[model samples]
Target: MTQRTPLHPVHLELGARMVDFGGWDMPLAYGSQIEEHHAVRRDAGMFDVSHMCVVDLHGAAVRDLLSRLLANDVGRLKVPGKALYSCMLREDGGVIDDLIAYFIEEGWFRLVVNAGTAVKDLEWIGRHAAQAGVKVAPRRDLAMIAVQGPNARARVVSQMPAVYQERVLALAPFFGVAGGELFVARTGYTGEDGFEVMLPAVQAPTFWLALKAAGVAPCGLGARDTLRLEAGMNLYGNDMDEGVGPLESGLGWTVVLDGERDFIGREALVEQKRRGGLRRLVGLVLEDRGVLRAHQRVLAGEAGEGEITSGGWSPTMERSIALARVPAGTGDRVQVDLRGRLVSARVVKPPFVRHGQVLVNV
Candidate 1:
C-alpha cells in the first residue's frame, strides 16, 4: 500500500500532480515545474518533506555507537543542536545512506534520513544499537516542511509562535532548536537560506495552510530535484548508492579518514586511497544544443569513458547541466553521447547555481 503524508489532502486540494515516490504518494508539481522551481530560487517556497524519517537516539552508548557506524566523526558536534552531514557505509566501503546527525544534548541525538532508505536504515541501526544498548526511536509522529529561498526565513519566522520567534531567528546555520512540539532547523537541501521545521503530524495541515496564506508557494518533487541539482547537492539513489563509495561520488569531504576512528568501511577506503587511480564525480555544462540525461555515456578521449549520474536542464542557467562519474585525469572538455551523436561539454566543479545566482558561465 502506498503511504500518504499528513498534508496529502492539502496537496490534492491544491491540484498538485501526484506520483509514487519510493512507496509514498508525493506531489511531483503543483502546476508548472519551472515556475515552482523559480519560486524557490527567487522567493519563498515550501516543500512537503514529511516522508523523510526522523530517528532519536538515547543512552550513554549513543555517541560511541555513532562513532563506529558513520563515516564522519560525530565527536565534532559538541554544542547543542549542532548538525553534521555524514554517510553510513557498509564494511566494504559502499555508501549505505547519507544522513544528517544533530546533537540535541548529552546522550541524545537526532537523525533525519532519506525516506526510501528509512526501513533498512532503521534495521541497520537497530542491529548495531542492540549490541551497544542504545535506544533507537523513530519519530514517525512528526511531519517535516522545508521552506526555502531568499525570503524563506522571514516568512517562516513570522508564522512561528512569538515566544520561539527570537530563538528561531538566533539559530545559526546547521543548528536546530526544539520548543514544545516544534523542532526548527536552520538547514535545508536547497542552496537558498531557509528553515526545515519538524512538528507533530496532526499540525502539518494547519501549518501548510498558514504558509500558503503567507504567500509561500507550494513546490513539489520536480522543483525540489531541479533546485537541489542546481545547488550541487546529491540525491541518495541517483548520485550515490550501495554500489558506489563516497570517494567516487564527490562526497569525500564528508568522510573522516584521519586518525584511528575505526568506523565502518574505514579499512576499505584506506586501501582504495592507497591504491589511487579512482574515478571522480564532476559537474558538466552542455556546450551542444542537446539535453543531458542520466545513463548517457561520456567520452573523455584517451582519459577513458564515464556515465552521467544525474542530468537535466538547469532552469537557473538556462542550459543543460549534469553530474557525471568520469576517469580520474579527465580533461576540462568531454563529449556526451546523446542519441548516438557525440555532443561537446565542459567539465567544471559542482554547484551550477546558488542563492538565485548562476555560479557557472552560461
Candidate 2:
C-alpha cells in the first residue's frame, strides 16, 4: 500500500496531481509546476513535507553517539537550537544518508532525515545507539510544513501568537525553536529565507489552512525539486547513493577530519584522499536549445567521460541544468550525449540560482 501523509486529503481537495514518490503518495503539482517554482522564488509558497522523518536522540551519551555516527562534528553547535547538516556513512566510505541534526539541549538532539531512507536510517542509527548507550525515538506523530521564499517568514509570523511572533520571526538561519507543541526552524531546501514548522499531526490541517489564508501559495514536489536543484542541493538517490562518498559527491566540506575523534568511514576517506584519481561532482548548463535529463553521458574531452547524476530543466533559469560526476581534470567545456546527438555544455559551479537571482554565467 502506498503511504499517505496527514495532508493527503487536503492535497486532493486542492486539485493536486498525486504520484508515488518513494513509496509515499505525494503531490507532484497542484497546478502549473513552473508557476509554483516562480512563486517560491518571487513570493511565498508552502509544501507539505510531513513524510520526512523526525527522530529524537536522548541519553547521556547522545553527543558521543552522534560524534561517531555523522561526518560533521556536533561540537560546533554550542548554542541551543543550532543545527548541522551532515551525512552518515557506511564503513566503506559510502554515504548512508544526509540529514540535519539540531541540538536542543545537553542530552537531547533532533534529526530530520529523508523520507525514503527513514527506515534504513533508523535501523542504522538503532544499531549504533545501543552501543553508545543512547535511545533513538522516531517522532511519527509530528507533521512538517515548509513555508519558503522571501515573504515566507512574514506570512508564517502572521499566524503565530503575538507573544511568540518576535522570537519566531527573529530566529537565526539554521536554528530552531520549540514553542509548546510547535517547532519552527529557519531552514529550507530551497535557496530562500523560510521556516519549516513541525507540529502535532492533528493540528497540521488547521495550520495549513491558516497558511493559505496568509497568502502562501501551495507548492508541490515538482516545484520543490526544481527549487532545490537551482539551489545546488543534492537529493538522495538522485545526486548520490550508497555507492558514492562525500569527497566525490561535492560534500567534502561536511566532513570533519581535524581531530582524533574518528567516525565511521574515516579510514576509507583518508585512504581515498591519499590515493587520488577520484571523480568529482560538478554543475552543467546546456548552451543549446535542449532539455537535460539524468543518465546522459558527458564527453569531457581530454579529461575522459562523465555521467549526469541529476539533470532537468531549471524553471528558474529558463534553461537545462545538471549535476554530473566527471573526472577531476574535466575542463569548463564538455559535450553531452543527448539522444544520439552531442550538444555542447558549459561547466560551472553548482547553485544556478539563489534568493531569486541567477548565480552562474548561464
For lDDT, the strongest prediction is 1
Local accuracy of candidate 2 as per-residue lDDT tens digits, 1-362 = 89999999999999999989889999999999999999999999999999999999999999999999999999898999999999999999999999999999999999999999999999999999998889999999999999999999999999987888999987999999988878999999999999999999999988899999889999999999999988999999888889999999989999998989789989999999999999989999999989878899999998999999888989888999999999989999999999999999999998889999999997
Cα lDDT tens digits, model 1, 1-362, are 99999999999999999999989999999999999999999999999999999999998999999999999999899999999999999999999899999999899999999999999999999999999999999999999999999999999999998999999999999999999879999999989999999999999999999999999999999999999999999999988999999999999999998888999999999999999999999999999887999999999999999999999988888889999999989999999999899999999998888998888876
lDDT for 153 (candidate 1): 92
lDDT of all the models against the reference? 0.94, 0.94
Which parts of model 1 are misplaced by more than 4 Å?
none
RMSD of each: 0.8, 0.8
Give the least accurate 10-residue stretch of model 1, judged by summed lDDT: 353-362
Question: What count of clashes does model 2 give?
Answer: 0
Worst 10 residues of 2 by lDDT: 161-170
